[model samples]
Target: MSTEKCVVCKGGGTIELLGAQCPFCNGTGEYTKTGESYLKSHICQCIFLDRKTCPLCGKKCHHDTPNKPKILIGPV
Candidate 1:
């Protein structure tokens, strides 16, 4: 397993919020392997906005009609 500091608050795990502590990391600055890697752990919300397809399988669903749903067939 690999260990690394929190990238959100730059290892301090806390962000100044009008003299209040950051709620994201809770001032710990430490995190462990919970399925997500350290490199890809810190991501902004823009990632979701830029995504138009599945990142894992790189598949895009096409909907023929608004009422009909797109079916995805693949191995999980």
Candidate 2:
């Protein structure tokens, strides 16, 4: 279950969540997690290619970000 091609609606899947709104960080999302400041300027995956907003919960989207493997000690 790993697909690719989305880079900001470039794949035509869908992308557009309040575009063109930067104005010196007026979006008020968040950043400065450390040096170089994180957030990458108000997310730029175009907007969220498609719409489900799940890119591993990283912020942007484009596929390749779904990895949920946690068993710890399972046996069922």
Candidate 3:
């Protein structure tokens, strides 16, 4: 286990205002990845501090398209 917080909610386990659980950590504020290959990976802590959505439209945004709002993650 890591002491680091979730990237989406900043350890709150849920998105602010929306009242929805973080899709990344699933509201646990912790991330762990496992695979069949003898290797495991974890998300960087810095990701938590990065902006998740566009400040203008309040929609999910990315650097790839500064003026467009796209679905970063699909339904899971």
Candidate 4:
């Protein structure tokens, strides 16, 4: 199932999901279409950085990426 896009992060904005090493693609900047959809396109490395703070270090973190990739279904 695809995740419901939030109002702010609906249009390919990785601001809501940013991290150093992206979990989904592991910073490869690529993804697969197997059992995926456009709506769930945001399911990537950024998703792992969803938390506002670092759970391990307990430091304040920011999840904003100016160079966010265009999250679409079929291709990059």
Candidate 5:
């Protein structure tokens, strides 16, 4: 986990950045894991525009899921 100044809101943590889920990998960012696959939370929007990702699996976000804060990783 790294903390660089946010490019959008400039670190306000309030700005919403534009992004797309990795379609080829369903936001898993990775092609495959050694054993278990990554997963996202049904209660938390796991995709952030450029910040945190799925800690366990490194997925950005699921494409089929709505791009809402409730599921993605952006601030809510």
Candidate 6:
């Protein structure tokens, strides 16, 4: 997947210039590992804005699984 530059951190992954993690990306200018993909270094929560994406697979679905915040990544 191609990651676009973060609108907030602009791909720098930090804001305020204090080394503080960007609230939107948690320091990952693109996306952060969240929900069931916590062990992963990256998550598609940001990539999947509709929130219907499968955590185990990158398939978009219509299931009603409540979004859990294992580590909330930003929305694309």
* lDDT leader: 6
lDDT of 5 by residue, 10-65 (tens): 33433233344433333433332321122323322345443335332344543444
Which candidate, 1 or 5, has the higher TM-score? 1
**Cα lDDT, all candidates:** 0.40, 0.32, 0.47, 0.35, 0.36, 0.49
lDDT, candidate 1, residue 16?
Answer: 36
Writing each residue's lDDT as its tens digit, candidate 3 over 3-62 gives 976555667777674678866677887743422111112222222234565432234443
**RMSD in angstroms, all models?**
9.5, 13.4, 10.5, 14.7, 14.4, 10.8
lDDT of 4 by residue, 1-76 (tens): 2354322223233323342443333333344242134333323344255444433222343323453442333433
Q: Candidate order by lDDT, highest to lowest?
A: 6, 3, 1, 5, 4, 2
Judging by lDDT, tell me the better candidate of 2 and 5: 5
- lDDT by residue for model 2 (4-59), tens: 33333323333334344332233332221331242222332323444334332244
Q: State which candidate, 1 or 5, has the greater lDDT.
A: 1
lDDT of 5: 0.36
Checking candidate 6 for backbone clashes, the offending pairs are: none
What TM-score, computed on C-alpha atoms, does each candidate reach?
0.30, 0.18, 0.40, 0.22, 0.20, 0.34
Worst 10 residues of 2 by lDDT: 67-76
User: What's the lDDT of the predicted structure labeled candidate 6?
Assistant: 0.49
Cand. 2 Cα-lDDT:
0.32
lDDT value for model 1: 0.40
Task: Pick out the ten consecutive residues of candidate 1 with the lowest summed lDDT.
Answer: 41-50
Which pairs clash (backbone N, Cα, C closer than 3 Å) in model 3? 7-48
